[model samples]
Target: MEKPNSSNALVCELINKGTREWNINNLNSWFLPEDREAILGIPLSSSNTPDRLVWAETRSGKFTVKSAYALALEEKVHNTRADCSDESAGKIWKTIWQLRIPQKIKHFASKAARDILATKSNLAKRKITPNGMCDLYVVKMRKQSVICYGAVIMPKKFGRIAGSGVVIRDDAGEVFAALSKKWKSPLGAIEAEAKALEAGVNFAREVGIREAEFESDSVVICNALQGLVSPPSSVVNVLAGIMNEVSYFRQWKFAHVKRQGNVPAHLLAQHAKNVEDFVAWRADCPSLIEHACMQDKM
Candidate 1:
């Protein structure tokens, strides 16, 4: 009989002690019942042979790199359960891949949505210093005339405020749409600026302007949108909502200009102060803002 090796040392000791003949009662102390049964089931061979390791995965009892890799993958899959069964996560990824935007933008947006991108907040959480800057690579296309929208708010007395303006114009300095409205409550200038931006973007969407640019004179609001500075905690949610709206655009950008360039919107906002309710004009320039719009175009 072949001598048992280190793997079966207890059995080898018994075999060396002239106890080669085995029975369940003799083997019970040294072997598990199932192991003993397996040993007993093997047919004894008349020819002597050396004991060798056998790989049960293959009929030839030899290991292959391919089989080892497969086994490792199986073990890994069995251990990682959280990511295996997530249905919505896969769907969201597929949707992002199918969007018509640039691949780089899609990639950035997807990472941002998952909160996994290297944003300042995420870096701070990992105990790393944030760069405090955002680098966006904008692809400049032919400078086609784009529809522009602007907004402004005015304050009044007795803790009551009125006047908000929205102006939309084409590249030729023609105002296609203009709005003036009065509000019942007072709002801070920054809050009013943000509200105006939201309203203007919504109006552009409503009017079927898929590709457009929006300009605001408020440097603070513009900087926040470009990721240059963090908005106050009070307005973070508002900024997030505006960003969500921006995602709907196929091509869009926000610009910060001198107050001189934003005169039309400013003038309309001032015009709102005297209005009782709301007024809007379409397909024609408002007499009040025509010169202001022309100056901006110049």
Candidate 2:
């Protein structure tokens, strides 16, 4: 057979033509010697099974837009490189891509890798004048004492219990406090989110913050907090608790934000799964989440 290209169709055709089995004898005739060796190295099932496609880039063996983008970027970089032998950049990309966090977080990280973000320093380097526009300026001016806090919850899965993370930051986007806790029992995502909000309120109260703004990725939970919708029975008690805590604040608001804006809390929630109990940091953020926090500030 002619040399096979790196196209999915070509790979599938080769596998299909080999009687749908990956044994050495069947694949040897179709693949080049190196490719045949690689195929043989993969462990095949003893029982008869149909062939299936797997995206080697992801642990789930499923295709994702992020993976496709990464593949295309890798090809572009390879073609632009002088030697094409150094893989340091590829190794860094793989490390970030393999993170177990949400896909949106990974997508943002990928953009950071490409230096696409237009930070003030980057604009200066490009000799472009900054508009001096700030998205959070109005909110900062309205409530000098107002602090924004993000809450996220990771539902129990793969033998892990529900985990919640909360991050509190000042108007200057500096972290004042953070929390991570793992629930003993499994809770649905909405319920866990409500719990996280409640925890955030309690933390704010403990810190004696009179004005606060709570943010969450879950629109349902944020709406319930804003009285825009009635919360389900499962989270009614938690909602009530959150409302009571809200009374402690002189002024407070709940806002629904996209996942990209809530990466710090999301990272904390995922980190909570591995810990045995809750953890709190005061006047500081965890080293592991510093990168996400910097991204948010940018």
Candidate 3:
């Protein structure tokens, strides 16, 4: 048999089998305090739903422009207040984001306002200590504009198996597809996150998306996808699978997001625990997650 990808014990595999209880020996053998406690805390599922793997994308599994725009606005707002204590400055974010300008330009404007240019202090913030100030650096235009938002739910109070969700929105920020998937075996949170992206990429490819962007709440997974960092040893295989799928696309982007910015996908991931039949939605929002989808537009 192939070696298990992670050193951690699989949640489903740790059951006492016929006795239907946790295998305490394996739990103790495999996990540290927090992980063990979290594993033990998983609420058993009454539905006994089989695990699922579903794919989707627009542009989805949303972590990119939306989150970046929000982050930029947040940073701009915070910096303005810190520098001047002027309440009026708080509206700068609103103003920048609300501009009639193109989305890309507005994002750039936000970055400029954030003082992201490598000035002496900014370089110092980066630990670069450069002697001088520095400076730095869509699509099918629409159809090709695929961005992904992906979220993962740990095995906690919800259910014994981990789950993940992906929502692929169009360039207009309208949801075009959604999916909630259960991991085949118990997976670490990050591993499940990588699984979510893998699902999104497969979805994109299935629908003949030649170019796409993907987003996730896990910075490690995003960084690995973007080649910004080496993938962790435990998730190497999962990341590898994602990269292989990504090769099919003519273009692709990876981004990191905070949990709040990824709420819809997070909700879908949480929904996975109770879904009786795994299915992917198209051209419509799943009612349970519809409100969250609408909220993403604002």
Candidate 4:
């Protein structure tokens, strides 16, 4: 940098005049031996075009605070896990606490895990309701399990790629399994919905869930499944495939839900953008949809 005009010079200026090679003379003139060696050791691009900075964390070369925070949190988790070999076995607690739900929910889960929840026994010792059950819990009771699915396009309005999310939970609102997946170049929105259902059925079968309610947020797809509306041309093949799988279920039903009611599945669909073929969890839900799952149950 002390050499005249070296401080402001671009790297392209140091390229050899007639070849795709480093200018040894210019490097020697402007840089110390170590610096010159490092420069020479750096791989040169085949293209001679001017270089530009790119953010590796995003699909686009743009940076966002959300991505940065996620990266930081991931690094923290990795480092913490690396530092405490024994605690690696305690990730179940980490999963419970890191749930994206409200603090009260987290507190309740922690208490339940410790047998300190205000259950009937605990409440009998106190002055609260004898059952110690909230309306949310009471209302969630069901006779059978249900697998709900949702779909989303990456860019929402115009993108061709899509995400498919599936969540399976019993009538008691206990999650059994979850799946998040990315699909490439779907024909359209309805097709994407069919794809999500397809993935859900496949996941359900793979996980040995023989019979359950099938739910989705796409009205068109659900109506088609129920034969209330004719299946559209774009979704006919995919929807048929879903039925072929649904046939294996001893009992099954198709259900439609609005966007808000399908938060867990919807968020899981959105989360699909971050995974490759898919992400799955058994007897556990992904932290990415923790808050959404709570919201859905509520």
Higher-lDDT candidate of 1 and 2: 2
Q: Return whichever of 3 and 4 wins on lDDT.
A: 4
Q: List candidate 1 segments past 4 Å from native.
A: 1-155
lDDT scores in order: 0.54, 0.57, 0.57, 0.63
Q: Give the clash count for each candidate.
A: 0, 0, 11, 0
Clashing pairs in 2: none
Error of 4 at 257 (Å): 1.8
lDDT of 2 by residue, 1-298 (tens): 6443322225445443333334434455444443443343233222233455556544334667987887677657645652324599677767877988655456555545555344534433322222333222211000111333333333324342456677778888898888776554334345556666666777778777788877776777778778887655445555766776677789988777666556677677777777886888888978978998888788
Residue-level error in angstroms, candidate 1, position 134: 37
TM-score of each model, in listed order? 0.47, 0.48, 0.50, 0.49
Highest-lDDT candidate: 4
Query: Compared with the true structure, what per-residue lDDT tens digits does model 1 show for residues 1-298?
Result: 6434323446445332332223435444444433443343232211122354554334333667876786677546534532325888778767878988544466555444544454445434432222433222211110112433344333224223434567766766567777765443333345556656665676677666777787766677789889998653333445566777777889889887555455666666666667765677877878997886677677
Error of 4 at 30 (Å): 50
For each candidate in turn, give its C-alpha RMSD to the true structure in angstroms: 31.1, 19.7, 20.5, 24.5
How does model 4 fare in lDDT? 0.63
- Kindly report which residue stretches of model 4 are placed more than 4 angstroms away from their true locations once superposed: 1-145, 156-159
Q: Which ranges of candidate 3 are over 4 A from the true structure?
A: 1-146, 154-159
Q: Is 2 or 4 the stronger prediction by lDDT?
A: 4
Error of 1 at 198 (Å): 0.9
